[model samples]
Each structure stands twice: as C-alpha cells, then as structure tokens.
Target: MISPLGQSFRVSKVFKRCPLEIQGFVFSADLIELSFRKFNLILGMAWLVEHQVGLDCVSKRVTLKVGDGEEVVMVGERRDYLSIVISTMVAEKLVQKGCDAYLAYVHDTSAVSSTAEGIRSVKDFSNAFPEELSGLPPDREVEANIDDDPNRAEFWLENTIRVFDELSCTPEECMKCVVSLLRDSTYQWWNTFVSVIPKERITWEFFQEEFRKKNINQRFINQKRKEFLELKQGRMIVTEYEREFVRFSKYAWECVSTEAIMCKRFKDGLNEDIRLFVGILELKEFIMLVERACKDEELAKQKRKAMIEARDTRKRPMSKSFQPQSKRSKETNLRMTISSEYSH
Candidate 1:
C-alpha cells in the first residue's frame, strides 16, 4: 500500500517473474522502509534475517545485532505521514554493516540463534540467515457550525477523549493527536486557536485550565446554557428529556456545576405540570430530581390517558337512536381531534 504522503511503490512483478526463487524469500510489500536515499535494490525479510537486523521502534532506531554489538541507523521519514524513506547509500551501509556484524556473530557456532553453514566465517551471502520474521500489527467543527451544534461539538470532545484514553497518553499528547487529525475548516480553526494561545510549552492540564479565560470559546457554552434553559419536558418522554438536559448541561458548566444549581436547572426545564407534580420541594439532590422527573412523566401520561378516556365517555352517544350516524364516527372524530391538537 502507498504511504499517506503519496510515496507510491510497485514491485510485484519481480516476484511474479521468479516465483520459485523469490516467492517465500521476499515480496513487494516489504519495501515500506523509512528510506533516506534511492536504492538500486530493495531488501526484504530474507536480507534482514541474514543480517540480523533488529528494529527498535520506541527510540526510532534500527539496530543490527551482529557480532558482539549493534549500531543505530537513522532512517528519515516523510513529514506528511511519518513514513520512513532512505537513500541508496544508507541502504548499502545498512547491508554492509549488517553482513559484517552478522557474519561475525554467525561464524561462532555457539551464537545459538543462528547457524551459518560451516560455522567458521562464511564467505557467501545467501545462506547466513534465519528462517522467520515476526508479524507487524499497525472532525471538526465547532465554532460556526459549533454554535449550530453544541451536541455535535461535545460528541467530538468525548470521542477524542476516548481515543486518548485508549492510548494512556498524557493530556498534551492527546490534544496534539486530535489536532493533527483535523482538516479543512476545522483544521484552520484549530490552527487559529493555536496561534492565538500564548506561545509557551505548557502541559495540557495547564492549558485546559487557562484556555477559557484566554479564548473566545464561551459561545458554545452559552449556546448550551440557552438550550438547557429552553428545554421543556412537555412532549418529550422523561428519558429523552433527561438525555437533552444532560447534553445541554455539558456545555453549561457555570449554571449547573453544583448539586443545588443542577437540580434547580433540571427542575426548571420540566413541563409546568410535571414540575408541579414532582414538587421542587422534594428534589433536594440531582438523583432525586431525575427520579421524580421520570415519575412525573409517567404520572403525566396516566393523567393524559384518563382524560382521553373521560372525554370519549362524554362524547359517546347515550341513546341507541343517536348512535348510528356512522360506524367509524366516534373513533374517527377522536383521531382527528388528537392529530389536530398535537400536530405542532
């Protein structure tokens, strides 16, 4: 596959042309090295094993455990994708040093891991190797449309947090990763934010604490706070209302950051009837507020059903002579009335 920076390569034909000699020895996909220069030949797993080349990923260093020691080789990467590419001279150096190191190591029969034929300093390059190599397993938005969707903005934050949590990285590293993934308008917005923030090397914890005071991102929170206040439990089920309340509350931290304020804000958003039924006096805590909202929602539903039944009873024809205007008249009338009233 090609790298993210568009450094494309194709070498399948080589193996196709000499399958018997090259099939298990090497293949095209093995050329995805962090090369530093152009190469006349691309080396594969066979060459690596033969040279006892070992990759040290964490330090970004390539090591060849030849003889009694190893050397670190620096392979430069493409800036766009961070994929490595190196020059032909570097490749030759790698191969030459690797041969010397491994030949020295393998020539000693007691090296245990490798057995080059005839043990004593092998001259040929083809047979001084091992058999196997192990496996290698490898949004945006906001301010403008961010105002239009505080919910979506919060979603992006939560998603980014989850990505970082999975990595167990520091908050700074997490934010950096998230920023790097942004593109287009979102990228531009973040870049502007980066530029505006004081140019100092600060930990994420410090920046997160100070960002609000230093940035214009308060609009999102203001929007959410407005939504939170405007929320109504009127037609929404208790569960749905709870979700809305929580979603809006995420952005409106100042208004509902405390237990009393949150409960009050939540209670105030409920439909008047449910709020009255649940009784603000009874909700001393956030949990109580949620439970009563749910209870009141069910109470409201039962009340509605009883009212409908009572209205039906009142509208029904009492006399047999008055009952036969139409077979579907009563049910049809009730359906029409309900639809007319709630269509808004």
Candidate 2:
C-alpha cells in the first residue's frame, strides 16, 4: 500500500466483511492491518459506494442507506487534542498517500505567562523578546568602522549595558543577550575569544573588561581625556558647548567629580562676554549654571540689539518737517543771504 508521502508499506493482513457498528447501525467493511499511526481504521471508497453512504464534511455528518431502505444520519463528535510530533519518515509516508498535510509552528506560552507573574520576571526575559526578537537580527551594512572609531564600540557597549539595567537583566542573561546583538566581525571575534578563555571563568564583568581592552585601547581613552581637558566653548553656543562637555566629561572623571567642580569647569569654557555675567552668580549646580548662562546670553543679545538701535537712531537723517524750528530758520536765512550776495 502506498502511504500519503509516496512511501510503500506492506499490508500485513486483510479481513473481508468485517462488521462495523456506527451509531447502533451495523455495516460490513474490509479491514486491513497497516503500520500507520494516524488512524485506527480507514474506510475505502468501495465500502462507501456499496452502502450508499454520503459524507457532509462541512456539517461533519454521515448519511447511511441500509439494505432495508432505511436512512440514518450520524453526527460527528468534535475532539480537541494537543499537537503531535511525527518523524520525517512517517510524515513522508502520510504525504505519499495523498493526505492533506500542514505544518504548524507552536510556542510554549505557559512558561512565558508563569515567568511574567514571578518576582524575578524582569530578569528572565529581554524587553525585545517574543516580538522584537521574533526573527534573526537584520543584516545591515556597518556604517562606522569599529576599528577606526573606538568611541562607537564604547557607545554600543554603554547603550547595551543601559538597556540591560533598565530590563533588570541578570549577569547570565546579559551575557546571552549581548552575544546575540553582535554581528559580522564582532561575532567572529567573540567566538575566537571564547575558544581561548575557559567558559567557567567568563563572567559579565570579565567579558566587559576584555571587550574594552581589545576595542577601546588605553591610548584612545587618554586622547579623549586630553580632548576633554582642552575643550572650550569658543564659537559654540551654550547648548552646543554643553552637549560636547557632557559627551567628553566621562573620559576625565577626576576633573568634574562633583556638581560644584562640573559647574566650574563648564563655566570656565564659556566665552569671555558670557562668563563676565554668569561668573558673578557663582552657581554651584551644573543644571542651574547652564540655565543661567543661556539666560545671560539672551540678555546680552537684547542689550546689543538695543545699543545698535540707539546708535542707528542717532545716525539717521531727520526730515525737514520734523527738524527744530530754530535749526530750520537758520538754514533758510543762510540760503537767502547767500542768494542776495550772489546777486550783488
């Protein structure tokens, strides 16, 4: 006998005229012994034709016409069973027999639901999972080369750590998620790293230290620290300067250790004009110092605008109608005197 998947199976034995009872109605059918596991018995077309049986798949009903000319309708029962896993061999056999086969992917939701209700639930799963982590990470071209820009590597590490902290991920979970995010050369590098280091000795901290040592070298860090120390506002606006100050401040942590020191360092970088106004306030808080500096810049702009307006007013020519009467009369008399002298 050919199975659904086109596999040949030998029928062991066949029984002719085996009486089968359906809804208290007796019918004769030929039963065959087969190795198929999906069904206990399958009725052949010849049996259905001889019995004048009609099947309504939509309604799940069967109509049987007996030899006594009596018609009986049998209603099908609905049964819900958990999915079964079958081997490839069995699947092929079923497909060969012309059975409609469908493949379904199932996920265990109970475990996820239970984890969500637990106290340590946040540490168990990533915020990206089940949705954002549904498929493999997309293959995108690397825009910035990690070798040239060590800061990019540091930024990615810092951002990943921040996300892990927000999700309350444990060290082990962090290790797993961090590896998944790595791609291309980075992933290959990780594989090489793990091969050298014993898995038992590797912790999240150890991984981080090694990663920083390899990607972000001591020379790069020293350069960044120097840049931070020499950073000045110069032509940059207060907001732009503040952004750069915050960005580079991490490398030189000793310089701006406290709020007072941070504020002072930031204030020292401002332009001379703005410093003259903000320095007098001596604000200790960093945020307040920035706000005061911005306010002072705006006030300075307004003052400069007012002064320019005043200067322009003094330089502007006055109309004859608006001029003082004494000044106008002196001019008119001078013109008449000049005209009379010319005539003489």
| Residue 72 error, candidate 2, Å | 69
Instruction: List the candidates' TM-scores in order.
Output: 0.42, 0.52
Among the numbered candidates, top TM-score falls to 2
- Which lDDT tens digits does candidate 1 get at residues 60-118? 55554444464435553633332334443354455434332222333666766744343
Candidate models: Cα lDDT each? 0.60, 0.81
> RMSD of model 2, in Å?
26.3
Clashes of 1: 15
Provide backbone clash counts, one per model. Answer: 15, 13
Candidate 2 residue lDDT tens string, 1-344: 87555545577698988989877888888899987677678888888888888999777788999767889898777633212524655665554455655548798877655432344442355564767555554333445545456989998999999998755466876898888888777878888989988889888898799889879999999999999999999889899999999999999999999999999899999999999999998999988999999999999889999999998887676554476669888999999999999999
Model 2: number of backbone collisions:
13
RMSD, each candidate, Å?
27.3, 26.3
- Which stretches of model 2 miss by more than 4 angstroms? 1-145, 318-344
